[model samples]
Target: MGLLVPVSVMAAPPSVGSVSISPDPAYTDTPLTATPSEDWYDEDGDPEGYVWRWQKYSTGISDWEDIADQTDNTLDSLYFIAGDQIKVICTPFDGVESGVDVEATITISNSLPTITGVTIAPDPASTASTLKATPQGWYDADGDLEGYVWRWQKYNTGILDWEDIADETDNTLDSSNFVLNDQIKVICTPFDGTDEGVPVEAVIVISVLDYSGSIDVKPGSDENPINLGSNGVIAVVIYTTDGFDATTVDVSTVKFGPSEAAPVHYAYEDVDEDGDTDLVLHFRTQEAGISAYDTSVTLTGETDSGTAFTGTDTIKIVPSKAKESVQGNEDAPGQNKEPGESATGKAIGKESAPGQNKEPGESATGKGKNK
Candidate 1:
């Protein structure tokens, strides 16, 4: 039993019962924190602290690899991504020696991508122009590669809802597929080859293409005279020129004069004496709304293919005899006479009877009459 006098015992290293990581299910966007159980103990009852080591499982290396400069208790989200396994080792230390390592692991979950600055170009899209959808910024927290899925839709008045355009999956839409006044939209969805993000959209309205064409009012007549008081028809001719084809005009869509009068009748002919065929339309004079002060009138119509065109021609508005008689009476003093009386209150010219033809040498006003 020798030196039972001074037998000294060495203190055991500190040890912890278990370790845990907060946010058990990890995401790429959030930071992770490791915590050790308070049940840690030291044989010598010395103060206890922990040394943390972070690591990640590498599929390429088929083993766990240490993360550089990440020995702290907490690990940053930027270091890992979805489908990645992250672990932290916590070793309890009592200043003299370190205890067995306690590890906690978590697997990162899939994260969605974000889309920013989505826009449709050609700011105001037109039926004759192509439309393109663009996204200025696309981001994914998990550092995943990104792709886009595009879908185009239009507002349908018949269904009173937004309907998807058939086979319009590309980012660009052709001009032939849309029409004026049509409301169009493009949707973009971002994916990371594993998951998809919230979709972003851009909207626009189609506008008409205004063009000018040649027209002749009262075709073949040098003076396109219009009697304001007459209940008759006025003929208008639309000519086919270098780029415009009058034959393509949609007769049902033609509108003329300030009244927006529609055509009561239509025909095809070479009214302009040109070899190309032209469109001839007839509109009721009373319905044309032409005024004596209107020097020019406009005709607007669309082609069968939906192209809008406009033309203007000079007009000569003529007043009726009744209107002329009233004007003459108002302009002359003491000239108010009956329908058959002269301005002097006389019954025509004493020599010439009503409806009688004037002699070859005599003037109609009773001037140069034979004695």
Candidate 2:
């Protein structure tokens, strides 16, 4: 019966095939999922179980890694951070001639960025100011962020005389040169990954201003217009042609009265000062008779960012009349002469009349002879 002795055969472990990723091997701010393949029984028909690990590097690495220490099943659904280069492997139980292993090279790019906050800044500020701007923010753990840009616009034109004064596209505005009392506006646009991020606009809506200056013009300073009832009164035409420059003006958002003759000018020059001179002279109540009436006009400025930096000027108008305007030489020959009093003669026309009485040294016609 000793020859009848027999032995049973034991099974070998299952084999682990190649490991790789699906959809894509490289990811940029995205999660990665893996599929595994293995037989339940070993070469000898024994039961099998698997052990898995997510390896970032080979054996020489000082540390070993697993999805939740190999105890987790969410391995395929986990999110990967930027620049993560990894591999996956599976070992089958019921020991075999060789262990089963699956591996694929994975590289993850920059992930989605997070926008934390934003801001705006200006440069070269002054009594008459200009503005320029830029922005800032935050990011995510596994992801990275990129560059930025800002967009902007004008605020209101209803209150301002200067409409084209603001230029927010490049982010800039100037007010020193604009007529006073103008308002400026601005906003910011952030250039973020995937989509347009958030926006930051002006913290202060409008800039108001009050300046210091005083000037008085009497229209006729050069021997002025005179009115003596029928004779006339000597009215000095002294006056400030252009008033003192206004301060803190937002040029982009401004408006003017509807018409030149709207009756808003505060002063006039040579219209009614002299009875005869006023009657024969062209009655112009405006600047150089160009507009024919007293009026106001405006100009504006910007500092690059298009924000209202300086306050407005609110230009003041000066009122005037022919009686207060400038008069040539009234003492000349025919000036105010009774029709018969002087043949002071038509020879006494304004140019000839005044020149005839000039001292040889005061006459340009005598320049060569006098010298």
Candidate 3:
């Protein structure tokens, strides 16, 4: 009978009646003390009390943790914030026990601050990326923030990682001149001093790639071959990669005849109609050199983008030994006639006028003279 009682006692040990949280649904930053108690199966006539234990059952970890053993009745205080599960684990007088763990939720507020406006000087930040700028700006929220950071990308090729720049705390530019092709980024920083900040960064594109052009001269066989008298047209065409024109040539610098001297030349361009401007030389060569004078043409010019380019071109003017008056050929008509003989006729040929066929009765000069 004792053995049978032992078996029955083993079969029905204890069960938990109730376990309650002192305060349900915890709030953020609140502290709570949990106390757990259980009802016994042998409350009325059982000989021995049931064994009991307390455990902490959390959602993430895969093991049950014992908070209290059969010899102890310890209360645990839980301090939690937002989305934590609270469970009062207990061993009851009954062999069949139950746990009361409720899923709880709370609010979490992020007090992280944001960086606001950024201001730069000397020009629009985007106007020159490689510019030296004193970085300055404002921020949102009164929370403590340190400095800012940003990735400076050039032309979208990749990050200029080697160009790691410091966060600007105030408006003051460093002495470093920007690279010819460098761009800029304006980042606002606070004093917490870490590399990270709530950075308000603006991208600046530096645009100082200077482009320029000018004119040079080279004389073709037909170009300016005729001499320029004191005010004659020197006929100088300025040259570019594109083509040649006649405006930019300063004729005043051309020294002909004998003395090397500067000439005055003006430029006129039909650029509004077709293209850019060029210079030409117009001067009269003094009659000192009957032979064509060989020399160079010089141009003094400043580029469209402010570059100075001076170029000289070699040219030759064929000389005439003596100035001769050109007269029409008057003796060709009598070459084909015999001595002292007169012949008057019209031939049907290419040299004849239209509608005159040299018919049988037609006279050469509309007179009675015949062929």
Q: What is the TM-score of each predicted model, taking all chains together?
A: 0.52, 0.36, 0.24
Off by over 4 Å in 3: 1-110, 124-142, 145-177, 187-198, 207-303, 306-371
Candidate RMSDs in Å, in order, are 16.1, 16.2, 25.3
What is the C-alpha local distance difference test score of candidate 3?
0.35
Which residue runs of candidate 1 sit more than 4 Å off their true CA positions?
1-13, 22-32, 38-45, 76-83, 109-111, 141-146, 209-371
- Candidate 3, residues 211-282, lDDT tens digits: the string is 122222211122324433222223233433342233433344334333433433333432111234434332
Q: Write the per-residue lDDT of candidate 1 for residues 235-288, one digit (tens) a residue.
A: 666767777788888888899999999977666754333467767677777788
Off by over 4 Å in 2: 1-3, 22-33, 38-48, 58-68, 71-81, 94-98, 114-311, 314-371
lDDT of 1 at 288: 84
Rank candidates, TM-score, best first: 1, 2, 3
Whole-model lDDT, candidate 1? 0.72
